[model samples]
Target chain A: MDSQVTRREVLKKGLIGAAGLTVLPSVIAACSTSSATTAPTAAAATQAPAATPTPNANILTGKLTLGNNHSDASDLKGVNAINDAFKALTTLAVTTNTVDHNTFQDQINNYLGATPDDVFFWFSGYRMRFFADKGLATAIDDTWAKVSSNFTAGFANAVVGNDKKVYGIPVDYYPWCVFYRKTLFADKKYTIPATWDDLITLCKKMQTDGLTPIAFSDKDGWPAMGTFDILNLRMNGYDFHVGLMTGAQKWTDPKVTAVFQKWATLIPFYTHGYAGLTWQQACDTLVRKTAGLFFLGLFMTGEVATVDATASADIDFFPFPFMGNSFDAEQALDAPIDIAMISAKSPNLAADLVNAKAYMEFWAKGSTQLLMYQANNGFIPTASDADTTKFDVLTQKAVQIVSKAQKITQFLDRDTRPDFAGANAMQSFLLNFLNAPTQDLAKLQASIQAFWDALPVYAGN
Target chain B: MSVTVMAGQRTAHNVARRRLSRGALYVFLTVLALIFLWPLLYAAYTSLRPYGEVVANPNGFFSTPATLNLNNYFFVWNGGNYPQFYLNTALITIPAVILTLWISSMVAFTISRFNWGFNMLVLMIFTAGNLLPPQVIIVPLYRLYNLIPVPAPLSDNGLMYDQIIGLILIHTTFQTGFCSFVLSNYMKTLSKELVEAAMIDGAGVFTIYARVIMPLVRPALAALGTLLFVWIYNDFFWSVMLFKSGDKRPITAALNNLQGTFFTDPTVVAAGSLMAAIPTIVLYLILQRYFISGLTLGSAKG
Candidate 1:
């Protein structure tokens, strides 16, 4: 009986002990992850390299590692193809480390602070500038000097850091446009809308024809920002849009209110229960001809092709219709460019700096960009000398559309500070407006400004 | 005779009532269990279907079996870097769990057996360590790991950062706190006379702990060992934060590889997740008897 009692006590103690240990830490993990912020590290403060990257008589033979976020099947293939091509040209062996796209973005702060790869794939605009300002990325002026003539002013500006030095090489970019099935349009006998009123009329026509006038989803939070970007760009022009993104212009301004009001006009045309759906599911609607239009990036083609390979051919898009304002002829659009840059903290940087710079220079060349473009045509080359003759019909039309634009913006998240643009900030605000578009605009605008004001200034900035 | 007959009829009626209630209770429990299992079943169903078809009709589960295939499983297995991920997780988790148990048991034995002045204080200190959130220490820990140099066999880069040994060390360090607290409490319930008797027989503290206390605590250790294995295996925060090399990450982090920039095949992701869950499920099943007995042993003290 004594033994039995002691054994029972032992088991009870063990249960309580083990349970406390296993369960509580996971709860702590959940709470702590949200508060994880990057502190500015003491990375090097050197400016642009002074010397031209003329290879010395000594052969460069060390390996250069790359941190890549292009994990999509074809995107990975495209990246690999470029690496293989770059390998054939130099004695430097290149190793690519591929991480999931979203995780890579979330972990970028820690990754760059740690032992980062010698070179890495990243976005242009503020996202690039954010890290560069932290002294995380190496400025590549020498590499840019060799490749400057191959790119345009837009591409050049996208890669420039706040310090006015080039931090990365522009590889490819995809424009955001209104995509619809060409066959569905022809069947409905719909003419392309060139003006705001014409667009409303077309939506009404599409609705009467038993189609969802617009397919929209913000379950992922960032998708709704596209609609906001286009509406703001159309109503207020590129300068105001940039000012608002940079917080130089207040959200409560009349021009910003006007953009929101205009967007409210098209709210009735959107698919119902959109807040629960993903962009992929919404893209399925456009592919199935259940929806008349989807305002998204050019990557919509990839989503479409995954569902039905033949259906991608029927996909066509037009820029958002003119808003009948002064910014109409500005022809501005979001053409977010992907970039490749060098890490200042890479342990192998000293051994492989020459090859790394050579690789960046290689990425800038039109021929090297063509290798990736050939593997994945969804992304148009940023280089001016990229062969247009090899472009497919869609690629040719995309290039033509981008070429005509007088001003270009990166996407909303790309253009703003990451902390302010994260899911908790603009993402949730946009989601709130979408969930209840009729909510008090004044209060919502105040909330946005307050959130922006509350953010700590970037230490390095 | 009538009185006896009336009693017999009442007994039969009561028996019938009890059987009906039992049937209803079983029905309720069965329904609850199916609800719990629905997600896993649905994931299995999705994994067997073509990714395209599943994406096109996310809710349509009434497809023919002919449309179901193992292509997604094959893709996740053959195409993904899962072999390396599994190997890395094993290298990290196995040693971490073993060391946590070994160190914790020794700590537990000392505090529970001895009548030292700081015995409770030592236990409290270990318990308090568990209360510190890992995020608060990540930056400092990262800097510390970078500063510490390991021998060539343990770390490829000389520093502890981005190495398997570093992950193991962190997991062991973080887990030992909770484990020691629980274990010391468990050991305290043991008969002190047993340790006193052994000591009188010329047994040292280590001998008493190994020969007597260890045998008594085997059930508790088994339970903890199982729980620790699962917790450490599923850890994403530490490995993803500390490791720079993608190839060195564990299987939990490998699930992100199936997600693409533009599009993700939910079916393929479901397949990969299900495969990742396999080892944990198997471990639980094998140790299920010990787990159950460990949790219930002291509850019926009355």
Candidate 2:
């Protein structure tokens, strides 16, 4: 009886404590509300107007968001600096933007729906065609016609859509090459190979020395596309290259077979554990001096150079040498990613388009080009003013190949179905090849055939 | 007297053999545990390595001279927008956990005590809700959230952190269905005599619940909180869609930013990945005792 009475008293106290806990939240809220001002009119009134020389609400003046290293539409300048620039440029305080490489497609999707940037960075080629197809990017042909410079002319055609309408101003004419460790080659008494067979022999020598000859990450679906493009250009030529990608040519063509054969030879010479490794990991092979060469995009300069600045200087590149050319002018595998576009339905549409034009012109300047090169060394310049000499000796050779190349082709994966790039066709090609190498040559042939057969119309063959 | 002593000695030998078998069982369980835990251990181990070290020795995980560089942690904390993300996550998780415990407990109590119109139907609906694919609802929910006239301060640059409420709602609402089912089943098995006795003593329904039910469910609360914390922390998709800006983003989002097209730097990636892992690991460590006890109690027949 005494214990039961004590329990009741304890329960009564617990109930009182619970009631007090409930009202405590309200009391805190009341105190906060009494002290807080809901509006910031007083703060806004005291602030000076941001400095915008000839601030035209009409210009829709905002900083151009360029893709970083391999990121989607973000600024070349890092986020905080980009935000400040955008704020100063627009006189409307812009906060921040972010981008990622693997997840760029989704980021683009998010940007398209909610807040399409005023002047976003983008790539050139069939990659740009999608934005043009969706009517997301505006035509800047008029602006291009007015800017009378060799850079504009060189890049103008690349950004033009299939409709013959220009959608974006091309910033990068990225030319990919076979980049190798110059130190490794020199140490082995190996000169940069001139022919396909010579390259093979060099790879064999490297393998004998227990070194990987090439560093390619097929795990990153797009990087292996470089090998195919380079090989196909050598075997078939530019027309076939365009035909196969545009879905006009058959995958079972003799040209594709030759290209596939080249890849088969190259496979044994590449770094170990290539199956799920990303391109960056592949780059690590070179950075560690375990591998010799890699077929990377012309834009790879930025990527390869960023591998610890001290170590990166040791890295250099060469033109991906071919046994021969597909066309009279040398054809190489290269294209663009990060294709910026403008909205057709934007209320600030025309003004935004003008700013976009101005941004292109502004970004294309030699000073700005120098700025970009300084910021990210591997940035391939479409503009003539860009000092290609800033690159190492081997990179200069690659730039020579790029500048004088007859026809620059697109990376096959990006030029194909954007959704399906890493999903089915290319995925099957790499995985099936890697796992089932001993199965049969017929198995490889059949895999390519199956994708080509089931491909939807408008998928470039 | 000699024969009886010999028989007792044989019995003792048999008891020793049985103890040996139990020890073998433990050894077998430990081996299986190691097999399951090896990948997690490897990931944690890799996390401790610097970027350059891991890159230099991709295949050399065991042998790599990795020093415990907390730099990756510092990078993720300041660079990854963790403070803001944590605030947003807390707003969602705390309220959701409380609401789940409160509402689920009430439902369980009512179900255990009383049968009413549509009680079974409500229970079935929750079960059905849990079974439906979360992905199927994403499009509709995206549309619905967009239509909410209460101007959810869209940064108008990209989607902002305020919209994390959408993710919170989704997680809370979905988890409630699964969590409530488990909790209700446990509540049903609870001794009915205590509640009945309290009612007989003239205690009200809530009073009986307050006195009899909560103390009994402490273990359940701990088990659910730990489980949900692990799931919610590791979640990527909801965080990706719901949060956009680097400042508004979580550690996972920050890690994504490190993947540049120009260069492949897996060092920063490995470091960043390590930082993301530590919190949940710490949570797991702290709650492991409760997890073991609660699970044993819930599964075992008393």
Give the interface RMSD of each candidate. Answer: 9.7, 9.4
Per-residue CA lDDT of model 2 for A429-460, tens digit only, reads 76677655555666676667677667565622
Question: Candidate 1 lDDT, tens digit per residue, B1-302?
Answer: 99999999999999999999999999999999999999999899888988677556635445545488899999898777565667667778989999999999999888877778998888889989999999999889988887897866566566789888899999999999888877777887778788889989999877888999999988789888888898999999898888877777889988888998878888899899998997777666556666676565434422
Q: Model 1 off-target regions past 4 Å?
A: A1-59, A458-461, B58-66, B188-203, B296-302
Candidate 1 CAPRI classification by DockQ: acceptable
Error of 2 at A393 (Å): 5.1
Alpha-carbon shift of residue A20 in model 1 (angstroms): 32
User: Least accurate stretch of 10 residues (summed lDDT) in model 2 chain A?
Assistant: A36-45
Restricted to chain B, the TM-score per model reads 0.92, 0.76
Against the correct fold, how does model 1 do in TM-score?
0.89
